[model samples]
Every structure is written in C-alpha cells, then in structure tokens.
Target: MLSQPPVWFILIAFIAALGPLVFFHELGHYVVARVFGVGAESFSIGFGREVAGWTDKRGTRWKVGWLPLGGYVKFVGDLNPVSMPGEEKEDLSVEQRRRAFHCRPVWQRFLIVLAGPAANFLLAILIFATFYVAYGRPETPAVIGPVIANSAADHAGLKAGDRIISINGSATRYFQDIQAVTSLRPNYSVDLVYERGSQLRRVPVRLGSEQRLDEFGQKYVVGLLGVRPPQLVYKRLSVFEAVPAACGATANVTKMMVEIIGQIVTGERSPKELGGPLRMAQVAGQRASLGWSDFVYLIALFSINLGFINLLPVPMLDGGHLALYTVEAVQRRPVSLRAQEWAFRSGLAFLLALLIFTTLNDLGSFGLWESVGRLIG
Candidate 1:
C-alpha cells in the first residue's frame, strides 16, 4: 500500500517549495528596480506582520512575514500594495516624488516589470537542466505492458509484450509518444503497427470512454484504449546527450502547459483547476515521499508555472504592469486614475472568485465533499 503523508509534512513542504520561488520572484523585481534607479523601500518574503528581518547597506529592509503565501517588493513612493497605483504620482513629497515608480522612464519601468517573470523562467530552465544532468534521462521503449480483456487494444489483437512500431505509419520511438498521440486525438480508430513473434502486424483499435473529473463537479468521459505502456527507466547519457535530453524535457513541459491552457479555454478543463497554497502543499508532500529527484522535478515544474502565471496580462501582476507601460509608451501618458481603479477592482474581484472556486475544487479533490456525502448518505 502507498503511504499517506501527514498534513504537517504537506504544509512544511509547501512552505519550503513556495518560499524560495516567492523570494526569487520578488528579487527579480527588486534587481530590475535598482537597475532602473528606482529606490526600493523594503523587500518582503511573505505577507502580513514581519517576523524576522534585517536592513541592507542599500537601506532596503529585507523581512520574512508570518504568512508564507506570497511576497512583495515595496518601491519608494508607492501608495498601494501594488507599486503601479495611479495616485503614486501625487502621494509623495517633492523629494520622495523624485523616487516614485511613475517618475521612471517607460522603458526602465518596462524592464523593471518584465524582470520578475523572466527570472522565474530562467530559474525553471536552470533547475530542469541541472536535474536532467544529475539524474540521467528517463526513456521508455515502445513496448506493450498489458492489454485489458475485451478492450480496444485486445479487440484489435494487441497483446502483452508486443513492441509498438508505429501509429498511423508514423514511427514511435518512445511509449510516451504513443500515449501523447492517443491522449490528444481520442475516439478515433488508430492504425497501430506492432512486432509480435518476429513479425510486424497492423491493428486498428477504437478508443473507449472512461470517467474523468474536471473543474466543475461534473464528471466527463474520455477515450482510453485499455493498453498499458512500459515504464520509463533512468538511462545514463553522455554529456552531449544530457544537454539534448534536458532541452527535450523543457520543451515537453512547455508543450504540456500550452495544452493545459488550451483545454481550459475549450472547457475540456475546468477553471476550478486553478490551485492555491493548499493544493501546492498536498502535491509537494506526495512528491516528497516519491524521493529527492521527484521532489526536485516538482519544484522545477511549479517554478515554470510561477513564471508562466506572472507573465499573464492581468491587473496587479508583472505582466499587467508591462501592459500598462506599453500603453503609456504609445499614448505618451498613463491611463486615468478612474480607469486604473476600475481595472484593479475588476481584477481583484475576478481573482477572489477564482480563489473561492479553486479552494472548493481542492476540497473536493481531497475527498472532503465525498466523505461528507457518504456520512449523510
């Protein structure tokens, strides 16, 4: 039986994983702010009241807060939590006004805002590359492990121990390739070429349906072929092969992210798929139990997600700041305060609603709702 993780362990793992990511993200903004000659008042890792802190030679107060959810960098002459507020122009004294974020040139502001997301992407790439080199590449030969009786693959005459050669005449080197192709283009009959007893044979299989959970409480049906592919094993590679392997891993992860986004857009995935700190902790704990390398991979993936999210053009995010800067560059003036306020308000509301939905989703995922239903039933 698989061992279940303790809640405390999950919480600890969440903090450990999120802390450095948050720090690096905020530090990216701070570094670019300094480069742009923007005076930063304080840099905080986490939110709410400060716990432990120290002042740097640059007069930036670096502090850790009680809440480990997220962090921020406070630039001089910023009125609101977001340094991009409209009244930041009028809120400070003449001397302080000179140090205001809005006072900076548009290009400088753009770079400052762009740095955070850029840093996250860079971190993800580095972490992924490092892990790849350290653990060797994982590879799965295109071999069949199992075929469920009377299922698609079995009906198509696919047998255990058969080596898959191609799908629709396209050569497949790895089992993952076949799985990927099947996952994306489900419900269609696939022409599979396989090797059995030294003979190559072609088989046509119709994908069958399986129940899957999405963002809404509704269960959806997905097509499955009832074929289990061989597992990926760690295969040590030469230095040259390691580099390509790392690049391939990164590319694969990027493709997965794009697919996930597309699925959400198509309503094939739920908006409630979004997760907060609670979900992060659960995943972190599960990965931690898997082993150090698995945990590191999870961190790299999460870091990439952080990078991708920060680049979204939503108000109060790094990308949102960049969007505003782009408009100011073109218009030669900032958007009016009323417009900024309304945008921020709407963004905040949207974020809150998303948070509530995701939190509910997380609870449901943990079987909380199901357990409650069982008790009542």
Candidate 2:
C-alpha cells in the first residue's frame, strides 16, 4: 500500500496541479471575449484581494489574487466577475457599448461563456496527445494471468492463460473493457467468452459483489470477476495516430463520468462518495510521489472533470450562462434582471451546500471527527 504524504506535501501538490487548470480555464473566456471585441476589465488568476497586478494596453488589469483555489475574468460593463450584466450598459457610449459583454449579441456572449469549459477540454486533449506521442500507449490485452480462489471466475471454471473475447456479447479488446462491463452489473450473471489455446469457450458467470470503502470511508458495491491481467504491452504511435487515440481516450473518460453521475442520480450509487478539494489534494500528492508521469495523468483527469462539471446546466456555471442565452434566443429577449439575480443567488446556495457536504466528507476521511470524539470522551 502507498503511504500517505504529510499535510504540507499534499497542500503544495494540490495547488501546483490546480493553479494551471484555473488559469487556462479563465484564459479561454478572456481570449474569446477579446476576439469578439469585448473588452475585459480584469483578468485575475485567483479570488479575494489582489496581491499583484499590471494594466495592459487594453486597460485590463492582470492580477494575482490571494486565494489560489479559483480565478475569474471580469469583462467591461459587467457588474462582477460572474459576468452579471450591469444596469449602466444601456447608458454607455457607442464605443463603450461595443466593448461591453452584455451589450454584445447573444451568440457572441454564448460563445464567450462557452469558451472557458471548452478550453479545459481542449487542454486535456492536448496534454493526453502529447503524452501518448512521447511515451506510447499501454495496451493491456484481455488475457487472464491468474484466477483468485473462491471468486466468480474460479466458480465459472476460468483458468490462467485464458484470453477474454467478449462479455455479454460485447467484444472486449482490452482488459479494461472487461472491468468496464462487469462493474456496471453487480450481482448479475453475464455470458463471458474466452479463448484457451485455439479453443473458444463460453461460460455464464455470476459476478460477485464486493463492498469496498474509499479513503473517505464511503462504501461502494462493485462487481468482481477476480482475475488479473498479464504485463502491459506498449504500442508506439505516430503523432497523427496519437491525436485520434487521445480524443478517443478523452471521450471514454467523459462517458464514464456521465455514467457515474447518472448512477448517483438514480440511487444506484451514493452521493457520500463525492469528493472535495481535500480528497483531490490527497490523490494529487500520492500521484506526485509516484512520479512526474503519474502526476501529469492526474492533471489530465482533473482537467476533464473540471470541464464536464462546468458544463452542467446549473445556474452560475458556464453551462447556466449558455442555457440563459438559449432562452434569450428562443424568447427573442433576455431574461429579466430580477429573475437572473434570483437564479444566481439560488445557484450560489446550491454550490455552497455541495461544497460544505464534500468538505465534511474530506474531513471525515482524514479522521478529524474521530479525533474530536476521542478528545471529548
């Protein structure tokens, strides 16, 4: 088992990993707004009081804020960094109106808001592609190395050296595919086909259910086949080949994330398993200790996650901005300012509640509450 790092290491790793992501995400919004002729008032790398800043030729203040957790861009004529439209937009001169985000066409505003998440996704793809081109891809064939005793695989007569061909009629090209298929079907019997020394065999295996707990003590019921794979094989690809492969990998991650979210929504999974910054910090620290490659991989995963999260249609997110633009397009008018204010307030509340819940989950994982209980006792 990997040993946990000290608190300082975790904090440093978390900030190092997250800071670049926040910068690029906000950069996307800033660039697009600039392209659309909208002037930005400020480009901040973090929140709270500004620590250092410089004004650009365009009069945009580029600043680093005290808080390094998140960042934002404030466009000209916006009331705040969240891009709430200013009431003074109507009274601005022609030149000022041209530079104002709210005064821009709905489509342009939509694109500007959409750019932030889009940038994060693009960044993930680029990073994955670069890694693939440099290091080649790991191809783990669906060949069984060993079958655990008393496992579903053992009960179903699966043997060492068997190569899995398909699960539940879906052809599996890699060992991960088998995991992907079985994980979603806990306690269900599935038809598994494999090849053993030129002979093909089909077996009905009832996947065993295992209750696993995370570092946070959150429980999960996952299907287990109890088989291990042989050593991984690396396949070198040309730069051109790696791009599409990287895109496919990103898409697969996105699909899996969506499925997990859906499972949580349907009560198939518990929301207690949700993690916050502290959990991320722990994972980041562990990956950093492993090596640079592992750390970069973690960054890529988090980047994709950040993009997907921002695309959710909850108000105050990038997706919510796009959603409002869609409504404006359909209704041939912008949503009322009062309605927008209420919606934003509600979104902020929802986000705060979620943050608090996840933070508590993190603290519990660190045994903070247990320590407190011991002290009280």
Candidate 3:
C-alpha cells in the first residue's frame, strides 16, 4: 500500500510544483503583451499583499506576494489581472492609449489572452519531447490478452488475441492508445474497430467503470474495457519523432481533461472527486519522494491541465476572454462593458462556488469531515 508523505514534504512539494507553473503561465501573457508594445503595470508571482518586488527599466513592478497559491500580470489600463477594463477610454493620453490592452486590435487581444494557456501546453510538450528523445515511449501491442466474460469486450464479442485497430474512428496504434480513449469515457458507448484473422469488425460497447487509485493515491473514474495488455516495451524516438509524439501526448492529456470535466458537470462522475490545492500537495509530495523524474512528470501533467482549464469558456477565464473577442471579431464591435461586467460577475460566482465545493471535497478526502462527525456522535 502507498502511504502519504510527511506534511512538510507535501507543503514544500506543492509550492515548488505550483510556483514555476504559475510563472510560466503568466510569462506567456507578459511576453506576448510586451511584444505588442502593451506595457505591464505589474508582474506578480503570487496573489494578495506584496512580499517583495522591484521595478524594471520598463517600469513594470515585478513582485512576489505572501500568498503563494497563484500569480497574475496586470497590464496597463486594465482594471484587474483578469484583464477586466478599468480606465475610461477618454482619460488616457496618447501614450497610455498606445499601451492599453483594449486599444489593441481584437486579433491581437485574442492571441494575448490565448498565450497563457499556449505557454503551458508548450512547457508540457517540451518536457514530454525531451523525455521521449532520451528514454522513449512505453509501448505494448494493441492486442487484447484476455476478455473477461460478461464484460464490455465480451458483450462486444471480442476475444483474446483480437487486435484493436481504432476506437471512435481514431487510430489505436498501441495498447495505451486503446486505454487513453476508454479510460475517460466510463459508461459511455464507443464504436471500436478490431481485427481477427484478417477480418475487420465493428462493435458498439457501453463501458463499465470502476473507481481506482494510482500509486500516488490519485483517484480516477476510468472506463473498464475488460481487456488486459500483454507486456511493456520501450520504443525510443529520434528528435523528429519525439516532437510529434510529444504533441500527440499533449493533445491526449487535454482531451482527457475535457472529457473528465464534462463527466463531472453531467454527473457521470461525482463532483466530490474534484480536488484542490491539498490534493495537489499530497500527490506532489508522493511524486517528489519517488524522485526528480516523477516530480518533473507531475509538473508537465499539471501544466497541461492548467492550460486546458484556463481555456474553458467560462467567464473570468482565458477562454471566456477569447469568447468575447470572438464575438467582437464577428460583429466588428466590442462587447458592451455592462455585458462584460455581468459575465465577469457570473464567472467570479461560478469560480467561488467551485472553490468552496472543491475545498469540501479536499477536506473529505483527508477524512476531516468524518473526524468531525465522529466527535459530534
């Protein structure tokens, strides 16, 4: 059985893991904004009160905050870090107008908002590519070893030695590919292509699912296909091969994020499985204790997730900004400030509710609620 790491280890691991990810995410926005000649008023590494800071020659106040949870970059003439509008259009001098974020063309604004998530995806890709180039991808043939009776595969009329060629029209080149699709789609029916003795077959199978924990105790609600793999093999890639492989890996993780979030929202998965900082800390510590490689891999995984989450179309997210910019692009006019404000308010409320719910989940994960209940009884 895997045991939890020490509290101190978890705290250190969490901070170390989150800090750089936050910096890179903000840096994406900062660099792109700078490229467009938009001046940043402040580049903050953490939220809340400033712990320490310095001004650059460009006059951007670079600061660290007491709260190490997350960070933001405040652009000139922007109301807040979320890039809400603040200053009136008429109040700005020509110079301020030149530096203001809103003054930029809609396409530019869209790219600027998008750069944050893009940076995260880039980080994950680089990391994965490096690993692939050095070590290689773990591969197993997409041939099934056994099909448990009465399971999804059995229901689909699959048997041992059947080679899965594709699922839902996507190529399943390896056993992991089969898993990547199936794991995220519990209770969901999928169209699968498999080959047996030179004959191809198509089947629609409704997956059964089970709750499982990884080595680090990360819980997952994964689809069960009732098919087992044969063994493990590592296929090293050239630099050219690694790059595309890494891109595919990044795309796969993002797809997983979208599917899992959709499942949660639709009640196919319980919201209680949602986690917050504490959950992250525990997992980080476990990975850290294992070694630097594991820790770095966690960083890559979390970075991709950070990027995908920001790209969600909810208000107050990068995706939300992109959504408005998209509206502006199509209409040839900006969304009204009043409408933007309402969206922002709604987004803020939604995010707060999410936070509260996730915190409760985290507490329950730690058995805090159970402990309190015991005391009450």
Which one wins on TM-score? 3
lDDT of 2 by residue, 1-377 (tens): 45677889988899999999999999999999989999999999889999999999989999999888889999988888889988566688888898999998999999999999988888888888888889887778999988999999999999989999998886778888788878876887999999999999999999998888655344567888989887777787888998898898898789879978887888877787788988999989888888889899899999999999999988889998888999999999999999999989999999999999999988887789999999999
In order of appearance, the predictions have TM-scores of 0.79, 0.89, 0.92
**Candidate 2: where are CA atoms >4 Å away?**
156-171, 181-205, 209-222
> Candidate 1, residues 177-266: lDDT per residue as tens digits?
677656654576878888998998887878766777543233555567677866666676666776666666666666668877887888
- Whole-model Cα lDDT of every candidate shown, in order: 0.77, 0.88, 0.91
Candidate 3: tens digits of C-alpha lDDT, residues 104-199: 999999988899999999999999999998889977899999788888998888988999999888799999998888887788888999999999
Among residues 3 or more apart in sequence or in different chains, the pairs in candidate 2 whose N, CA or C atoms overlap within 3 Å are: none
Q: Which regions in candidate 3 have their CA more than 4 angstroms from the true location?
A: 146-157, 185-189, 204-213, 216-221
As a whole number from 0 to 100, the lDDT of residue 36 in candidate 1 is: 70
Q: Is candidate 1 or candidate 3 better by lDDT?
A: 3
Better of 2 and 3 by TM-score: 3
The C-alpha local distance difference test score for the whole of candidate 2 amounts to: 0.88
